[model samples]
Every structure is written in structure tokens, then in C-alpha cells.
Target: MSTRGGGPDRRGVRAKVEAQRAAERRAERRRRVLLAAGAVVVVGGIVAVIVVNFPSSSSSSGLGPEGMALQTGPQLASVSSAASGQTVDGISCDSSEQVAYHIHSHLAVYVNGQQHSIPYGVGVVEPVPSTVNGGTFVSASQCYYWLHTHAQDGIIHVESPSQKQYTLGQFFDIWKQPLSTGQVGPASGHVTAYVNGKAFTGDPRTITLQPHEDIQLDVGTPVVPPQSVDWSHAQL
Candidate 1:
């Protein structure tokens, strides 16, 4: 009887040991599963961030109204001013599919083809300084942000293919110039220009332009004299 009772107690102890071992195995598996899941989530989050900031070829940010227009022929530059005594429509910006306004470093703001009141000299965009120093870097997407520091006089200017142009002081009117997509030539994007006090104008200097394109003002010589070829019936 003592041996039989001892046998039953021994069996119970063995069974308890087996149960503990089984429970520990299950706990380990659960820990491993949780770790794997955590790693997957971390990797997935990183991929999502890369997709958001840098879109793949499958994505596009969509073009503005000017960008959507069908371009036909050589491009010319456009200009507008609040004090020019001409309304936005006078510059054909109201119904123009190519109207672009430069307000500071921002472009594509007025792509709606509607003439909006913009403060003159209040906000203007300029080209990178490297371009003026015989650099071939054209202002991207019709607008640009330029960086330059001068101890003495610093001014921004605009010149069109027709040799029409304007000069802007640091605290003066905002200058806007439209670039035509129609023009076909080098120096097409920007006329080689430099900064000077004298305003420039003359015969229609050849410049390359695309439909609905505009370049902001910067300190550079108006390589193209910026004069209107046909002011009476001109679409300048």
C-alpha cells in the first residue's frame, strides 16, 4: 500500500512538471510572435513615410491651370502692375489660359485665369545668383527663389523677349513677367541680364518662352531689351 501511494504521488509530480514546461513553451512562442509583429509595424511605418515625402512614378501632384493649357508657338513674357493704370484684364489675365502671377517666392497662385489684385513690389521672386554668373540654371516651373547679399544697392528687374522690362526696389512695387512657351531658342528661358539702375527697352529681342510661363524679378542685366514689338494690338 505504501508503494502504490508513492507511485501515484510520483505520477502527479511528473504531470505537474510537464504542464509547467508546456506553459513556458507557449509563453516563448507568444513573445516571439509579438516581436515579429513589432518589427513588421516599424518597417511598414518607415516605408509609409518615404512614400509620402517622395512620391513614386505612379503619383503626381497635379498641374495648375497654366500648366494644363495647350501650348502652340513660341513663348513671350507677360507683365502686370497694380499702378500701371491697367486692370488685370487689360493684360488679358482674366480669360487667359496662360496667365501667371509672381507674388514673392510663390507661383501658380493665380492659375485660375482670373485677374486678382496683387500688391506691387510687395512680393516678388528672383532667380538664383548662379544663373546670372553665366550659369545655365533656368528658373524652374516659371518661378524661383534667389539668394544674394549686397552691402550697397540691391535691386530686382524683369525683362521680356520684346525688350520690355521693369526695375523694382527693395521696398517698391512687385514686378511680374510672363514667359511664353512658344519661343524656341537658347537663352530662351532667361535673357542674359545684370543689375543696373537704368531700365531697359528696345526692339523685340529673341527669347524662348512657353505658353503660360513667367519669370520673377532678379538683379541681372536685361540681356533682352524688353520692348513691345506690337503694343497697339499686342498680347503682351
Candidate 2:
């Protein structure tokens, strides 16, 4: 009888050891689950940081190919004569050295020295290309205008690189509503101009030019006459 009782006690101790082993295994599995959850959280935070710092790929910007949001407002700049070495005002300026833009909208054009504002962004009915002696020519619709130095032909030509059927009048019409004027200055002997705060990259500059130099300023986009729309869409 005693021997049999000892045997039963030994069996009971073995059963307890097995149960303890199973409990230890369950505890280990719970620890593994917690560790995995922590790792996932850490990795997710790292991905979020990378996405936030990425650059934007949008149109209508100097940086991107698409139209993207930008900062625009009234800026200050000057348009000088390319031929006579004189500072031409809006009234007596010549088409070769100066362009007096008339704005149909109620927008204000503050002159370099004049305290009161003037009317800009109006008058011309079509877009025409006028080369400058020093500054580069660009269409307003493709992008904003930023010029350096003065050219002989100080005119802003209205033309669309898109070549869509739109009138120069229509383009400037849209601009008069939202556009503001800025200034053109010099840097390292190089004269430049920025219209409507479009050129913000280099140091802040103004519009100044040597004799016979030209600076082109775009006040609006050129519209393509409907008769000129290329059926060349067949090229596609």
C-alpha cells in the first residue's frame, strides 16, 4: 500500500512539470507577438518621414513640368530705354524701347518713382514676336516672364508655346484679373527683371539695361485664332 501511494505521488509531480512547461511556451508566444507589433510601428514611422520630405511633381512651376501652386503678388521693377540710355515712362515710351500695357481690369500698376498706380494689361489685340537686343523672349502662357538686362526691342510679345487656339487678348484678359507687377535689377554687372514675383531664385534684381539693350516683359498669353487650329492632330 505505501509503495502504491508513492507511485501515485510521483505521477502527480510529473503532471505538474508538464503543465508548467506548457505555461512557459504560452508566455514565450505572447512576448513574440508584442515584439512584432513594436517593429511594425517603428517601420511605419520611418516611411512617413520619407514621404513628407519628398519634392512635388506638379505643372505650372519653374521646378515642375505641371501646373503647381506658387506664391504671386505685386512686385516692384523698372523698364529702361535700350537706345537713348534714358528711363522711359509709360506715356512717352516707344514700342522699340518700351511697351505701355493697358489692363482692362481694375488692377493697379505702381511705377518705380510714381506714387499713384497706372492702368496696365490692355490694348493690343493679337500676339506678335518682337526680338530684343539683350533679353530673351518667352510666351506668357507657357510660363511667367523673367528677364535679365535690356534688349533693343523692349517689347513683350504675346504667343503661346502650346499653340492652342487662343487669342493674345484672351490671355492678357485673364492675367489682368490676377496679375501684379514686380521689378528688374542688376547683379554682377548683369541686369535683369522679374514680373509679378515669378523669378525668386537668384538674388533680388531689377530691370536696368545698357544702351541699345532690350528687355522683354510678358503681360499676357497669346490666343490662337480658331481658323489656325492645326488639324495636325492627325499626327497623333
Candidates' C-alpha lDDT: 0.29, 0.29
TM-score of 2: 0.29
Query: What's the C-alpha lDDT at position 52 in model 2?
Result: 74
| lDDT per residue (tens digit) for residues 151-187 in model 2 | 1111223222222222222322232322223322210
TM-score of each: 0.32, 0.29
Clashes of 1: 33
Tens-place lDDT per residue, model 1, 10-112, is: 8888899999999999999999999999999999999999988876633322221111112222222222231232222222111111213221111111111
lDDT at 98, model 2: 23
Error (Å) of candidate 2 at residue 142 is: 28
lDDT of 1 at 211: 24
